[model samples]
Target: MVIKVERVLHMVGGGGETSYATNSRLQEKAIYRTKPILEIAVAEMYRTLLPEKMVVVDLGCSSGPNTFLVVSEVLGIVGDLCRRLEQKPPEIQFFLNDLPGNDFNNVFRSLERYEKKMEEENGGLLVPHYVVGVPGSFYGRLFPCNTVHFFHSSYCLTWLSQVPQGLGSEQGVPLNKGNFCIAENSPPQVVKAYQEQHRRDFSTFLKSRYVELSIGGGMVSTFLGIKSKHPANDELNYLYGLVAEALNAMVSQGIISENKVGTFNLPIYGASMQEVKSVIGVEGSFDVEKAESIWDPFDDSDNVLSGKNVASTLQAVMEPLISHHFGDAILHELFSLLADIITARHLLKDKCNYTVLNSNSLSSCHRRHGH
Candidate 1:
């Protein structure tokens, strides 16, 4: 069955133990690491545009403290800049966009508290900002043409708009059995399908954003990427491989059928820097100012505890898609098995670190006609 990703794909909601809100420390860390880059991007945009009303968007802004963290960071930068210049701060129109299935209600409910916190912190100098929630896929346009001034996304673009097609045969046979991602054992066709999907989706993303951004506007996006051009050689493959192993264990216990495991593939890709740069070149909409790759490998000094942390993080991100495919009954058992496999077979054995790619200060090629 083809997955309707926008209908079901989302990080686990709320503040529960298995929720994305509770398990997103890894993503939070990435945000802080990318903060300096974000600072430069925002400052440059404001100095260049100096619009009385600035439009800023955070794509794939999932629910949690991390969501609010972005808001605070942007406000702080823009507000401080205006204060130092003794200029009137632009009214910020901030949009937090994600798939329709994201926990926007949770994000909405927390807004009042966030506002109170901001007031307590920034006081009289707070930038007049309006926060709006936009629900939709980023693969398509979300705003009017030439309206938005800046965009920021973190740990989101790795997800494809949908799972790649041709993973199964016309006769209903699953091709990439026993794995849900581009693994060492994944068929060549399976790998090719993922690559094509990433190229198509990412190109469409750039094209759409190019149309939406005003002249001189840009976006900063940070996401998972493979250090090696070969997809199978990366730690990202092994990380998902552990999850596949846990699913196979369930098949052994007759909890889920082999066909069920075989048919499921994650709608995510870890593109190499070359692959990303290639897409940007082909799209020809934005100019990349700076791109850097950071190593955020898991710490192995406490492999036992770190193993559990990895399991929890993956569970939060993967639970929605897995539960939709295999039923919610097996979630606890599945992640528990994953934790054990991670501790025994992987983290305890080899010190591996996942790679995070930060691409920032991507200003649109569009500029004022005479400039």
Candidate 2:
């Protein structure tokens, strides 16, 4: 019943209403907001190691306009620093990574345009930047040991490799039933199960990256998080909770089987700032330089259209996963349910449902590596 995330998770690519390339303005804004931190990371890197040749990798880099934005920020900073240092810009080996199912064709098609922009903006300092697509998962090694210099991953760490191992019973019944993710009403056991899965998966991720980063090499990561450690403080439940409610409504009218709702859960976790730092600390491979909660999703806007936006955005990001689990027949109904749920849920914008996390793990190896 478990779908390999590498085969199931990806944004809808291309120019369409549900396409991430078209509707990821919110994610693009989030990336823009993190530019300052990215600049700081790159600047600090130049202070110590200004190599004539450099290597940078972007993990979980889905295909879209947002995919290039982070690395572009890093590239700009590197270019500026080189000019100030009176040093020739480095020949960057940039890798854009994501699941194998990602629409890499779309990204590759956009590169000429991106390069043209970079050349004009940087005075041709980026003349020889070499970019390639790397398909894989960050939960495991994707590059050679000690090879990468700067690694950037944004808005993707919250996805678990699989559902928590112990959320089911001896009879094969779900222990954390009726919800797609952890929620306020979830039992303590359910909470612990999710926490443990995040810990293990994140630990694996750090270990792999630790082996890949050269000394003084660093990473800047942004992912979904929570305002507090307590499960009750979860702010992301409104969307999933509403999804569950909609299904329940259907079940009440015998529209869908109750067994379907009981058996499904999203392999995602919205960790608290504490959870993020704690894993970095426990993983023992990287040092956490700066870790903090950046912005509140609710505070980002009270747009009456947020529900629609949320549905469109998530559908673009998660349709593959949903369809893999429940089949495409339910997509229309499911998203309609989600849109209505967001429209009705009125927990003020600041209640902390969705949060952007900031973490700079300043930690490589070289033999081909990735993820």
- TM values, all candidates: 0.96, 0.91
TM-score attained by model 2? 0.91
Off by over 4 Å in 1: 170-173, 299-301, 367-371
lDDT of 2 by residue, 159-223 (tens): 88887876665476667667767877788888898899999999999998888888668889988
For all candidates in order, the CA lDDT equals: 0.88, 0.77
| Model 2 misplacement above 4 A | 123-127, 170-173, 298-302, 347-353, 364-371
Best by lDDT: 1
Question: What range of 10 consecutive residues in model 1 has the weakest lDDT sum?
Answer: 362-371
lDDT of 1: 0.88
RMSD to the native, candidate 1? 1.7
Residue-level lDDT tens digits of model 1 in 1-371: 67899999999999999999998988898899899999998998888778899999999999988998999999999998998888898999999999999999999999989989999887753799999999999999999998998999998999999999888754666678788989998889999999999999999999899889888787899978899878988998889988999999989999889988888888999998889888998888777788999987655348898778899999989999999998999999999999899989888877668888888755445533421
